[model samples]
Target: MVFMNYSTSTWILILGPLAVFLVITVWVIELLAKAPPWYPAIPIVIGFAVVFLALGVLIRAKLGKIVF
Candidate 1:
């Protein structure tokens, strides 16, 4: 298959964001499904936190600054 011809780094580049997106989508959906009506800000705040955390990770990864 054409996909099989990609290099290892190419595979990681393709799969990393995809995996992050899938996980975040599932997490948000599950939170909304079970969250109470009075707790709407909980998801928004947590979503922002997750977004910042992901952005930090993306920045570090882009800079090749991973410590571990």
Candidate 2:
């Protein structure tokens, strides 16, 4: 099995969910306020997905294997 370095995993684990929560919270507020329908969330979600995926890839690359 592989493991991520403590710092990398810690930051990713902390920041990833924090960021997602903030973004979604704001998005929901805007949604409830009936903001423009054209303000799609797909891009925001996709952006976060890419960011987290890249963080995962970075961890894997640094550890030289998949992390559990």
Candidate 3:
């Protein structure tokens, strides 16, 4: 058996894009389809926040090593 150890930055690099893609996709779909008026706006805001945060992390990771 082989075990792989990944750092925090590495994990973020791996999952960040996937998360952003999924969030954006869902948001788009929601936009195209009709949603209930009761639907909250928090998810959309959170999605954008995640994308920005992920981009920031990726930029920092590429420019220099991440401490944690």
Q: Highest TM-score: give the candidate number.
A: 1
Q: Could you give candidate 2's per-residue lDDT for residues 1-68 as a string of tens digits?
A: 23344578665764576577667766765674575664676567557766866785566557543342
lDDT of 3: 0.64
RMSD of each: 6.3, 6.5, 8.0
- Candidate 2 residue spans exceeding 4 A from truth: 1-6, 35-68
Model 1, range 1-68, lDDT digits (tens) per residue?
Answer: 64466678866765687578667766776777686773566666568767876785676556543331
lDDT per residue for candidate 3 within 6-53, as digits (tens), equals: 667777766677678767767765764566663576577567767877
Instruction: State how far residue 9 of model 3 sits from its true place (Å).
Output: 0.5
Give the alpha-carbon lDDT of every model: 0.65, 0.61, 0.64
- TM-score comparison, 1 vs 3, better candidate: 1
lDDT of 2 at 43: 65
Least well predicted 10-residue stretch by lDDT in candidate 2: 59-68
The list of candidate 1 runs beyond 4 A from truth reads 36-68
